[model samples]
Target chain A: AQSVTQPDIHITVSEGASLELRCNYSYGATPYLFWYVQSPGQGLQLLLKYFSGDTLVQGIKGFEAEFKRSQSSFNLRKPSVHWSDAAEYFCAVAANSGYALNFGKGTSLLVTP
Target chain B: DVKVTQSSRYLVKRTREKVFLECVQDMDHENMFWYRQDPGLGLRLIYFSYDVKMKEKGDIPEGYSVSREKKERFSLILESASTNQTSMYLCASRRQGTTNEKLFFGSGTQLSVL
Candidate 1:
């Protein structure tokens, strides 16, 4: 079975400040990791994903995440956040070659201008 | 670009009524999925179809059923609408054998049961 854990339930950051959201996973084999963002009344949008190769992956909207195999973590980071960055973010994981993803409870980000 | 569209953006249904949520994808993807999003539960998969007329139950499929009569369409059915079933339902699609492929999602349908 695959599972994803996001420790932070909520995070607040000032606009133009750096931000980091933590995520961890439990899977038997090499996992396929993903980050998704959801705005109010909107469906989830893929932020970034990690399958193989590079340990760091860049996503849309100036977001990026580092995949650390030893830590079992794939944390999302942004150099600077904007007011529009406020939304619910989810970290998901799936087993190698498996299509279904197990998602974390989610972390709600509040950006203050 | 992959375009996934849902039938309704907002819906209101009475308790005990059967509700159907429709989803269509233009990418001709072989895999389609239905999930419900709650306040703190993130997204829980309700059902998925990998081919026409083939359905698979996901983690939470107790009160929901699915139909896929065509490759481009997938429908989610709530046997009987209930207050507890009110949620934001999301539909997603992905191509088969593309294990690393990202899912494309619809805007979502917010269903309210009265």
Candidate 2:
């Protein structure tokens, strides 16, 4: 079974500051990686995903993630974050070509004005 | 745009009561999934259906069952609601035969079993 580990449970940053949420996965082989965001009282939305090709993947809302095979990580990064970006972020993986996705516990992001 | 709609936004059920969670997709997706989200637990897949009348158990299917009698609708049933089942239930749908496709999710139903 593949599992995603998000070391940070919660993170706070000032608006316009750079942000990075760490994510690590445990899988024997390359797996489908994804980053999802959930706003208050809303469903989870896809931010980005990485399957193959370039190691660096760009996503919506000025966010990006790099799939580092050596480090077993797919860390999401944003050079500057907006107050609207304050939400719960999750890292998910679909292993063994399965449709079922395994998600991390999630990291709650807080942005200060 | 694809839209997944769950029947309820919030539900309150008593213990030992039978519960049904309905999900419908506007798009003719071939796959639908049921998941439960708990604080500090993210989301756990309960069941998924690939086609009408085809259902598969996901990671946490021990306490839940699913029905897919129609292509665009999938239903999750809790035989006996328990306090432990209190959580946000989410429904998602995806196009079949595509690995790169993302799942379209509903707003989710916050179910509370008392």
Best-fitting candidate, measured by DockQ? 2
Tens digit of per-residue lDDT, candidate 2, span B1-114: 668999999999999999999999989988889989999999988999888999999889977888899898999999999999999999998888654668889999999999
In model 2, residue pairs whose N, Cα or C atoms come closer than 3 Å (at least 3 residues apart or on different chains), thus clashing, are none
Candidate 1 lands at a TM-score of 0.95
Per-candidate DockQ versus the true complex? 0.66, 0.67
Show model 2 residue runs off by greater than 4 Å.
Answer: A96-98
Interface RMSD list for the candidates: 1.4, 1.5
Question: Candidate 2, residues A1-113: lDDT per residue as tens digits?
Answer: 89999999999999999999999999989999999999987778999999889999999999999999999999999999999999999999988454678889999999999
Error of 1 at A84 (Å): 2.0
Q: Residue A67 in candidate 2 has what lDDT?
A: 99
Which clashing pairs does model 1 show? none
Candidate 1 chain A weakest ten by summed lDDT:
A94-103
